[model samples]
Target: MKPQRRLRLGMVGGGEGAFIGAVHRLAARMDDRYELVAGAFSSSLENCQRTGAALWLDPARCYASYQKMAAQEADGIDVVAIVTPNFLHAPVATAFLQAGIHVICDKPLCLNAQQASQLAAVVKQSQCQFILTHNYSAYPLIREARQRVLSGELGEIRFVEVEYLQDWMSELVEQTDNKQASWRGEPAKAGAGCIGDVGTHAWQLASFVSGMLPQSLSAELATVVAGRALDDDVRVTLRYANGARGRLWASQVASGHENSLRLRIYGSEASLEFQQENPNQLWIRPRNAPAYCLTRGSGVLSDEVRTMGRVPAGHPEGYLEGFGQIYREAADQIWAAIDGQPFSGSLLPGIDDGVAGMKFIDAVRHSSMADGKWVDFSAA
Candidate 1:
């Protein structure tokens, strides 16, 4: 194989004090397949300049707006990672895709399904890869679980239960000086609050692991925080195509919890359980048999999982490692497309995953407003 060229990456949003922007940079650098060449670090010009200088980025490559950055970096940047707030995702992504750059975007693709559809059209027209960072799907054990279900070891999955809960905003943290909680609690910046933020992760993980799309859903949303415009908690019940039933709950106001993402899948012959806090191991129980614990680097793991697993069985790899896998796989696809070569392996989450997530969010929002009635997600 010829030596792969490093992709020149431009970032939109993710300035000082932003959570996910730095995470994207770290993930991209992990595989050494991409370089951060340019960025519009923040919405404000001064912040963008300060952030650029802090990162040792060239002044010429940093811009005040994504529109200017996209036009200027079109010939240089191979990919653009959009890490801005939810409302900016569609516009920034549209700008880059229109300029012929592949996009690796954060989840909850856009503010609405219509915006997601517009972005999808651009992606199709450009024929460029659009990777959605559903980072949970990159976990080695999660990959193993997916393969097990596909291989019929689980024997027809029938139910899925996914929950992503956090206690950060439980008690009106947004009223204080917490930067993360402030904008996230605002309806304009964060989109649909908990449903658009963490709920999308739970929804994506359930579908990614189960290989099923939600057909319809019933949902309820709550604003536990006083004076908050958007929901801080969400509960959704999902109906899948193959008669599978699933439930998802995401809350920033769940007391005593912090980034606790859990998934349980039950089938006719077996069941599997995986948790984000304990990412290295997966619990598997076959019908009428003893329960088994599968670790990331163990002999019981699949080739795909093993290849992605970086450490030994006793050692641990968590968020950073899983995030790195997503970036590496994305880089593989981007580089393949750039070099006019075929991609090597599957990367589960893509533009379609983004569309599905946006549809899920919109459907749940509609369902909540409709007195928790079932809403057809297909219409999204």
Candidate 2:
């Protein structure tokens, strides 16, 4: 294969000091597969120019609005990354997709299923790659877990449990001018607080590893913080078509925890556990046998599993590396299409997964709104 030029990348958001935006930029740069060239980094032209200059970008490429950025960069960039607030995701993504450019979007898809459906149409019409950044599933061990479940190493699945917890929003951080908390505390900008932000992540992780989407759900959403507008705590019970039962709990006011995302899956023959904080290790316990652990880059892992990690054994790679893997995989598919070739099958997620996540979020919201009543997942 001949060497190709780096893909030109643009952004809709991720202004200075924006946490997730910075992470996205870092991830894109990690594999040296893409180059940041233009963006509508902030609504304020001053902020946009400031960010562009700080990143050594050509100031002419920094626009005042996403609409202009999309139109101007349509023929200049290979892809655009959508890292805006929840409410803007759909429109920003639609603009870039309509411009015949690929998209890398931050998750929870959009505000609701309607927006998801609308984007689905745009995605299909454009025939452009739309990658959803469900970065957790890109971790080497997480991929290995998915492979194990697919290979029937876990036998008949019986149960699944997942949770995501964080303590930063335990108080009224929004009132203190905390950017993330400010937008998150408002439903208009955030859609649904903790549930959309992290619960969707837990839901996706469980489905990704277990290879199953639940058939129905009963959910309860609570605003643990006194005056919060949206839920900061969410609990959902899942029933699978194959008789598997699952539970998911996501909370932003969980007191002592910080990014404590965990998943446990139990099957007739074995069970496995993964904790995001302890990302390097995966524990497996087989019935009537000793439990063992698999660490990232472990020599015993299959060659495929080993490729998920960048560095060799004994090197710790977590959050950033996991995100980098997603970007790397996206570059592969994007480049394949650009070269007018049939791409090899890859696990990098796309539109269908995004739609499924939105459906789950909507189902949980509907169930909670109806007093924790069961909602058919099929209807979602």
Candidate 3:
């Protein structure tokens, strides 16, 4: 075995006050798998320069626009991390993929299903890896829950309930100076409201853990906040292909809830529940048996799940570490691809998952428009 090299990483669109951009940089740096060599941190030249100075990157490496960055830094960048708004995701990702750079993009894939398919095709042609940042799926307990479900400990899953609630949009914050809220509220920028922003996350987490995708769905989307164009609340019922049923509720107007993401799945013999707010514990209720908790770094966890944890049992690990796990696994796949080594099972969401999410978003919009009539969903 030999020492591995760090991937040269470039970023797009995480300037001052951008929350998720900092999260991506932190995740990429957490495991030392990638180095932030360059970035087009903002559309404005001044902001780009300021962000570059703040990150201590060489001033020459920061470009004013992603187009210039892609053209100029093509030879230097190994992976391009796109943390821009939803509308820019497709164009930025396509530009870098065409430049032969691998892409690690923030979620919802793109603004629409057409863009999703187009990017998927480009990735296949370029043979560059595309990793979608569905970060919740990387949690250690999520991995364990997935393992236990797959191992038949749950004995045929019957129902799934997933909700992602937040109070950030309870009022008309977009009318104020909230940068994050402003962009997400606009249909042109975000594509969809709560459904695209956090609903996709809830849907992805459920699919990741339950190993099932919805066959059909009926959705009700509402813009509860006055003067808002896009939806602020969403409720959907999912019918899986295997006869399993699920319900999902994603809302930014749920008062007093901040980043409350929780998932519960009930099977014939037992049930499992995990909450992002309390990420370390997984509650398991077995039929005719006492319910118990599965904690990260514990003896009962699978080897694969244990490896995702960084500390000893009972010590807490949260969002940053979970995000770091995805970064770690993505680095493995990218390195294997570059070295011509065989990559096994997927540890991170890929182009297919991105497309699937877009389809889910598309279906939700369609179903809501059709007065909550059932709409078929296929991840193909």
Q: Tell me, by TM-score, which candidate is best.
A: 2
Please list the Cα RMSD from the true structure of every candidate, rounded to 1 decimal place.
Answer: 1.4, 1.0, 1.2
Clashes per model (N, Cα, C within 3 A): 0, 0, 0
lDDT of 3 by residue, 164-196 (tens): 999999888988899988898788999989999
Expressed as tens digits, the lDDT of each residue in 4-107 for candidate 1 is: 57889889989988888999999889878788989998878889988899989998888998999888888989999999878888888888999999999988
Off by over 4 Å in 1: 2-4
Computed on alpha carbons, the lDDT of every model, listed in order, comes to 0.87, 0.92, 0.91
**What alpha-carbon RMSD in Å does predicted model 1 have with respect to the real structure?**
1.4
Best by lDDT: 2
CA error at residue 146 for candidate 1, angstroms = 0.5
